[model samples]
Target: MIQNNLEKYTIQLPKKLNFVLKKIDSNSNGIVFITNLENKLIGSLSDGDIRRGMMKNQVTKYVNINSKYINKKPFFLNYNSDVKKILSYLESKKNKKKYKCIPLVDNKKVIQDISTIESLRKYPIINLKIDNSEINNVIDAMKSGWISSAGSFVSQFEENFSKYLGGGYSITTTSGTTALELALKSLQIGLGDEVILPNLSFAASINSIINVGAKPVVVDVNPKTWTIDCNRILEKISSKTKAIMPVHIYGQPCEMDKIKKIAKSKNIYIVEDAAEALGATYKNAKIGLHGDCSCFSFYANKTITTGEGGMVVFKKKKYFKLANQIKNHGMSRKKFYFHETVGSNYRMTNIQAAIGISQLKKIKSLILSRRRIFQYYNKRLRKFNYINLLPENNWSTNSYWLYTILIKNLGTKKREKLIKNLLKKGIETRPAFYPFNSMNIYKKYCSGSYKFSEKIANNSISLPSTSISHYDQDLIIDILIKEINKLI
Candidate 1:
């Protein structure tokens, strides 16, 4: 119950049925606990119990602790019960349909708190770990009244982020989608141009290419890396191919050496959609350093968040300057209100940057925590023959933004049923991204059979990773194993 105030939910015995009814009405959960003079919990009452009591006693005016309607055998837990104990009780088959809230009682049977289903059963796929540092920075930004796109924190965040990636020109944007769009626009790769990328990625990747008036050339991902098949890039290339976007899916870095070699020989640009792979590396270099330009997201679910924001890192100053101009409505930097080129409002706010600055300070620790979680999941689930763990190639370090697994031989329907059953048990799971060509708008971009991409999308499930406690992880693993066992 997270140690909340329990006064509103507790009441003494010698009370009228109407009084108990009012107490239940006052509380949001529609429940009230009846206690004795020593504050010892005796029973509980709900709206349904009161209605039944009214009919049984012919609308009795008064009720006591011993009333027939008082539920003496109410489900409860010890006041000092840990999270695992609470979750286990809630997930028990006996309590599934009967109880939505449980009373926390001490050894003496004195009620201490109330735990609701919403409180005890919540297991989010991702949760932010914000501290006082982030709060103070945001408050400082607000007090300074430079809350918009103009402020010192914006530049500080850019500088810190660039330095983190081993030095590159960086510009902030409204979102990762905007960062990708700006990257494409900065390179002058638009109409009559084509960009090749893997079929398995967030919709933003393909949408960014289409938004820039470029045809997205979709290709199959490798079965092991779950990244773009560098071996297939050559056959998909043409004179119109301006760039090759290799997405680091699930924070697993693509085989950049091969992709870079191909791009060099073909004289094609490389724009990386690194939104999911920040802090990850291909070989020893960070993810954003391999391509001509790379985009990263700072959305809420990302390793580091700014509420909603993104960054673009460029390999050259020319592209950086051009992208900066396009980000702020294409206004000339030297003159006020002077329009240099057609652009959109893609600038990130100072307040968001302030939060980003605080998050960036702990980026290393955050990445380590995610990696540890991945290792734990791998160790526990490896013995099961029905699932394949996330890929961590020898040449790459996966940040493991999400602990995803592929269920062997499971079709889409059975996999969805597994997800649904887990969700019903209060454990959240995410299906892998659908192949780009599967969508109606991208059907025309289908070039060949993306069998591997489709198979991954159909069978993969991303488990909860961020800020999850060891107890929560155990609960999820237990329930997941049980449910998967049922399916097979």
Candidate 2:
């Protein structure tokens, strides 16, 4: 039988100070713990607290000081308490202060030394099976000794994915970013070309544009769905604009029909960055099917897990052959060292393809699960007056890869306070990405108003979104509510 009762522990508030010094001497300057006189239930300290405390004291060197910060109170809860209840308690504190990991304390005010919500919750580990699939399908290819890149599974997987997404031809690559690069290269979009996309997207999108020697024309995302505005693209398009790579972000499809219409009118190519939008549809067609070429990621964190893999899907056979050559060092025929064009090595292994096959079969179930989780958050968090959930458009159904929120008038102090409070109660949270223009690398490249993106960068939060149980979900909502309630 399983037990969920509170245990007793103690913390010697005095010994914790000495322990901090000992840890520092062992070259572990940042590590901190909590204990009682008998090393029972006391709270924990951290390296951050030590540094700040020393800095406040004007002590540059490590000298023993009897400041209360050394025995500072840590966020903690009884092991048996309802996780949501503890999270609520932490949220109350976080909306007002700054902190890191909270401790898990039992009854008798004893600290358990455990610091992370993942550790406290003890989430199940996903067993990674690299190459365990039906290998018999390739038995004939193996017998013929054509194992390198001519495996049946690769062709079959590509064919199946292409058919599934509608008449597109699938061209596999070693990674998703490379697929983007190949797609751009196949269209002859390079150097003098400029492609438009949203500022709030993965770094891979930017890297792919650069890889093809093109300039990325970043624009602010729509405040509602965090996607590039289809209408906004018209103003940015010029004779120098060769193509537009619209990212289907967070598993939500961009307004592809509108984007396609604009591209067609302007006689420009369209490449769909479907890395995060696999299985997402726009106007009854998949995003991949709507563009000249669409790229998909098969990383472990993606909807489908293939260790590290990617693919580019398009309608034309000509583009498929060009992509194939682009991925294999710009060579067309085997056994001949003749180079047709400049290319790089970006081929996915048979082993990765094997895993991808199984994952692809499970894609429908995975998307449904993620959508259901998103609905749960929507239902619960909708009650908060200050928080705005992501908006849905009539053109597409969101796969909702990540449940995000924007807090109205949430400043840095309040945001940090809320995070600290949530952490103290054994809850985890991550802030939204800073604006692309604000980043050091793109300050010179980007030129325009980004007030919308900047607002989200400061107010947005990415809640826990692993494909798992809702055990921590309720706790997160409760904590968020408590923090927001305090501000009101």
Candidate 3:
């Protein structure tokens, strides 16, 4: 079905019933399409058809192709048919039998290829939904010769994104990693300083700390929320501790009140890795508003994207000004080319910011789309007793960046097998991030056992959470259940 050699599933019309049966047995599915001498599709035959023919006649193997066993009016689609049309035929109510494999034919009814459920489209873990606005803005920015960081869109994006998070100062960066590094540099958290963060997070969170000459103190995450365990913070804290970087994993906001109280009491900073939680909230307040510095990623897979960009928001103007200066090589604003402090090039291009502005205009709908996808997965997967759904606490609103679930009693090997089997069926899945301390490079940071983080990393699978249609979601769910059942 995926434009390969489909010869095994095709046979000449003059072939005997026994030959057709052999072809059906040899093919991946239990079916074969019959073609004439001109290679024009004439009919189709299945194992069941041969069985019925044998039951009706004693000498079925000797029966020729003109018998009643072959289905003459087989369902198919034209080669030019689009994905929507193919999906319509597959989901058509008129067909009593759910079609698993449909032949794609030329205008003259010659079998050009085959279309299986998987061939309809390769459903990715994340699909970017780009409309005309983004394209036009990028074109406009290019035409205006302001494609670099000096253009107006950069400041506009910063202002718009800051206002989106309830009034704060924002600085655009080349990536979320740079934003985190900039935030640390602006806060003067470097050299002998230590940053406490969850072990179960993307590498960027801890990498930023290490990049800024700070030591990373890895702690485990809460089993239910999959967020940094608030109770573990104090135990890992030391006199050199300068900040507690809490990652809002998979778009679920961390328990900010508890983290805030801890940071306030210890006289430490709260730098939020809100890269995956753009519109997420805690206690009805947006996530970026709670921390001293909150960083967001605008990667292609995020809720809103600028292709390869990030933003860092600050609660104080001094930090914002320092970050702005540092983001552009620490050049003094008043005196051109006068260096104030050593800094790196971490500026977001105007073209990327133009795309960001367009994406921001549709942020609300994008957030809603992600929530709708989470709800769909929740409603369906809740019936399965073996599944643990993604957390959405009563006090917080999850952006549901990726709809993740954990299978009870499933181990790492079995989960990997499940992911592989899903891939074979054209569904993509992501395993949870391996605990930081589990890696040899971060072993020096390992202080305590990370039982919960390891457990989640072993059993959790993040499904496709982009703007996929309900039909695609149904397919993913069905294949996932079948594969998970087979593996577990």
- Number of the top TM-score candidate: 1
Q: For residues 300-346, could you state the per-residue lDDT of candidate 2 as single tens digits?
A: 66767666789999778898888888788888676567789888888
Tell me, what's the RMSD of every candidate? 7.2, 11.2, 8.3
Q: Which stretches of candidate 2 lie over 4 Å from their true place?
A: 1-150, 411-426, 483-488
Tens digits of lDDT, candidate 1, 1-488: 12254777888878877787888988777788878889888788888887887788744678786678878877788755766667566666544545567887777788866767665544568756788899999999999999999999999999999999998899999999999999999999999999999999999999999999999999999998999999889999999999999999999999999999999999999999999999998888889999999999999999899989999999999999989999888999999899898878899999999999999999999998888778888888999998988876789898679899999878778889998888777677889998887888998987888999998998899998876667667778888999998997
lDDT of each: 0.87, 0.70, 0.86
Indicate which candidate wins on lDDT: 1
Give the runs in model 1 whose Cα sits over 4 Å from its true position: 1-82, 85-120
Better of 2 and 3 by lDDT: 3
TM-score of 1: 0.82
TM-score result, candidate 3: 0.80
TM-score: the better of candidates 2 and 3: 3
